[model samples]
Target chain A: MSETKVFGMTPTWRRDVHTHYCPGCTHGVAHRLVCEAIDELGIRDEAIGIAPVGCAVLIHQYMDLDFIEAAHGRAPAVAYGIKAVRPDKIVFTYQGDGDLASIGMGEIVHAVNRAWPLTVVFINNAIYGMTGGQMAPTTLLGQKATTCLSGRTAEANGYPVRMCELLATLEGPAYIERVALSKPQHILKAKAAIKKAFENQVNNKGFSFIEVLSTCPTNWGLRPVEACQWLEENMIPYYPLGVFKDFE
Target chain B: MAKGRVEVREEFCKSCGLCVAACPKKVLRISDSINPRGYRPAEQFQDGCIACGICARTCPDVVLTVYRIDE
Candidate 1:
């Protein structure tokens, strides 16, 4: 039964662009949440996105808003500049774990410390999806990656970096939340968190950071379903989902 | 009475089966047929659809759109 009234379609802010993300990759889900938040806020015309150097490096192709490509892990710093000049516009950065939690760590820390008015969507997929499944800073202890073929050990590889927990300790950010895309219920929570992060910027609040625990089926070397199940069973326990901090 | 139905844009579907797993009403299934892109697209059973849009929301590829008819 084909119906006529459209209850839901892809968000308009998302260009009619086919994503290159591997099947079952949650990056597309994250992309939809960002686009949906922009559409709901009616900020499509005024919204600007900072694309990072990761699996979502080609984010500009999927999102229809004005975008500037940032170097590896420097999206927050780039967004800082954009927000300072175009204070009237909505600015956001979309970054992946490899780019955000590793090389861009200092930049993100500084931006949050300064309380820049911008939205940051951090995708924490545990492994570096773009660079052929390399271990990322957010990779859980004992998680296997190309670099850590025998599983990450605390003795040699150090510990997984919990970005939300680290940033919430700072006094600058007004909102900080971590959500996941492993299930339908989790997806709804993620959307709400994403929207709140965007709303913080709209309300002239300080930095709003939403760290999304996403899945990397290709990198994780698992079927799409298995990847999501693995995320629920493994990732959620370490990176618990919740609002780390919210001033408002 | 069915409240809503899903339209699968076959060309874009990666056949990840997330929608099938997500449908609370259990109305979706991966078709035996494969798309030109070499992936199986989800097909709706059209029987118990409440049009909750959960399947569409859960879709990573934006391959499915939920449409509801006026009662």
Candidate 2:
């Protein structure tokens, strides 16, 4: 039998570096999907990436692209400035839950509300991964973190922000979608959604926001596979998945 | 007896078992031998593989590579 390689090691955007993520963390999967989308759309050369403070603060080490590290929770503002000046480049930002929904909330809201033609890849792992499992603004109720040892309660913690729904309420964004990296089928769909977001910017559609529900096994206190199962069982229900809003 | 072949980049494997769970053919398993990084890597434990690329797709570490075989 002759074997034809359907999938292999090289995705042009992926650099040759050891991934430092935890055993079960899906950040690598999320990175791969993002790379695949860029490869398909042929935007690697013109793509400019903005990474804010968090686990992926040094994301440029893994992916071979021009990257800028923004102030904590301020990637969206930086991205907007870059896009405004260099309208020819495809500007995008990769942000984490705490950075995007918490500290950078105002930056993101205003950027999307202003309708900047930028692609935002938001990774929501619920808890703050790099800072030692602290509760994030998107952390679900009943989930325990170092900051909230007992569990997140509505009275004490307030509520998890549904970013897609929140941003969809505004009339600025051209597209808003939430997808998970828990399953292979879902990963495929995630790749498509992300590709579409890049396409939107390439076609000069409008601001595109793609929320990725990811896993943090070490921080979540679960095995890698178990954390994925937990995401499917717990996170997906509250976060939900699908295109919350799309322009045409 | 297999219609597809799979290979795992063991050095990069994080021993997460995501590929094992994602494989529909049940061909991959965590190997007993640990890699240089001290984590057990995934291996092809059986013969019935359809090479659907699910393992590669689900791998969080970008470890698995799938190939379709033509006789």
Candidate 3:
């Protein structure tokens, strides 16, 4: 088969820094966005990326930007610290649902409240992908994960946190949007939002957050394509994508 | 004969070999040596290619482009 299936995508970064994500996980898509944003912003030299725990811990390895690995749920705080000192450099935090909405909520809320010049790329797959698919704060009602085999019950487990809506309540954020990377069209929109969030940082704007409702097929127990479909059908309704709030 | 150009932008590659491993055409290979970032760059056998974008999709970096040239 002499099909044009030769070689990997040439090194936009490096080859050896292999990702630890499961097949079909959208973390890779998110990583590429960070790289593309840095490349497009021409800030590869002056960009600082803060990677949070919960599956995105190794983001430092994939992105070419100067990366700092933050403690679980503390990326926003670290990002705030960096942006405060190096105000000239662009700073962004890539976080997952558990890391953002769960233990790190206090830090993130305070940071956004203070209107820090930082961007947050939050990945919401509804379940914890790295730690064996536990129920995450963003997990939809009735959704099943390893910890919620019988499905999530609000009486015991609490409600799914709508981050876009939650963050929108704060008037200081410069931009807020929810997007997905499940398909080509959605991926393009996600790229635009991600890039814009970074650009907001460069413009010395207040906090910007783009929540990406991503797919984790391996954790969700669906095929890669099916996972995307599940997201489109079940997840999109609960977490609709749109501009939550934008500041001029 | 029309030839499609498969451009691999080395800067975007993470070189996990998913494409090299997934390609049924076996036109992709990882170099023995590593780059400045300590990752191996993928090598292409253009003669054996059929201009499929599978490698590009499999590539996490989105670094490979398959250009279909009109004859």
Candidate 4:
């Protein structure tokens, strides 16, 4: 209790609990951003978060707000259902790459195409972190995972899918951005993007999606610091961070 | 005399060392004490801290609580 206690002591949006995320895993960073965005916007009371499959499936345990657990890759659909009936409440989906880009791809496309007034936090860590590091739809080409021990090959594994770019091409989205959590500066920007996504809904600005390039150090087989460096070095180049579309 | 200070909830820290790396002032170091989780938590170095909160923001686990010290 000193210095008048100006800042930093666990935001009110999240419960003060020990998280299950691996040490240095960017899912921790991404989770805090979501929680902070909700608290910062003062929408915690009316916000409903839909978390689908992957590592964040149990995020409901961490966040204090109401959460709807959707089937893997079906968070968009769940978000749509909630927003459709209770339009007054803010609805968002926190999903991983495998859930958002692969299995639940159709749900997301349809929800965006329909212009659902929802905020989507897409955590893209490339490899499938929850299932022993399998190759995900967003897995970087030449990146190695348990499923691709020798590195992902073009002929065998195809190519990485850019979610922000793909969704930007759609006619319905109000905002689309791809941000990363590699450093403090980038995390600050990511926080801004997430807050903006929620703000868009509060202002009735149609659909918003933020694709966060996160790190999975435990699965990636790298130290936490090295994984962050790896993301900045490799993922940033291919994913190309920035706003793909604005809230126009 | 530091302008700001940080308090680490040691039990919650995973000893990932991200905070140590992110600290621009080099004021944090992984401690020798091992928690029940078997990881060394970071400790604040003596003085020289600007209370920039970069270490707090960069932490994956919400373990660090940064505060600005008054006069």
Residues A43-137, model 1: lDDT tens digits: 89999999999999999988778999998989988898888888999999999989989999999999999997889999999999998999999
> Scored by CA lDDT, what does every candidate get?
0.89, 0.90, 0.79, 0.89
lDDT of 3 at B33: 67
User: What would you estimate as the lDDT of candidate 2?
Assistant: 0.90
For residue B51, model 3's alpha carbon misses the true position, in angstroms, by 8.8
Candidate 2 colliding pairs, count: 0
Better of 1 and 4 by TM-score: 4
Q: Give the TM-score, chain B only, in order for the candidates.
A: 0.91, 0.93, 0.77, 0.93
- Stretch of 10 with least lDDT, candidate 4 chain A: A4-13
Question: Which numbered prediction scores highest in DockQ against the true structure?
Answer: 2
Give the C-alpha miss distance for residue A128 in model 2, angstroms.
0.4
i-RMS, every candidate? 2.7, 1.0, 7.2, 2.0
DockQ of 1: 0.60
> Which ranges of candidate 2 are over 4 A from the true structure?
A13-15
Alpha carbon deviation, residue A232, candidate 3 (Å): 0.7
* Candidate 1 lDDT (Cα, 0 to 1): 0.89
TM-score of each: 0.96, 0.97, 0.80, 0.97
Clashes of each: 0, 0, 20, 1
Off by over 4 Å in 3: A1-12, B1-64
List each candidate's DockQ score.
0.60, 0.84, 0.13, 0.67
Best-to-worst order by DockQ is: 2, 4, 1, 3
What is the C-alpha lDDT profile of model 4 across B15-65, one tens digit per residue? 999999999989999999998788899999678778888998988888888
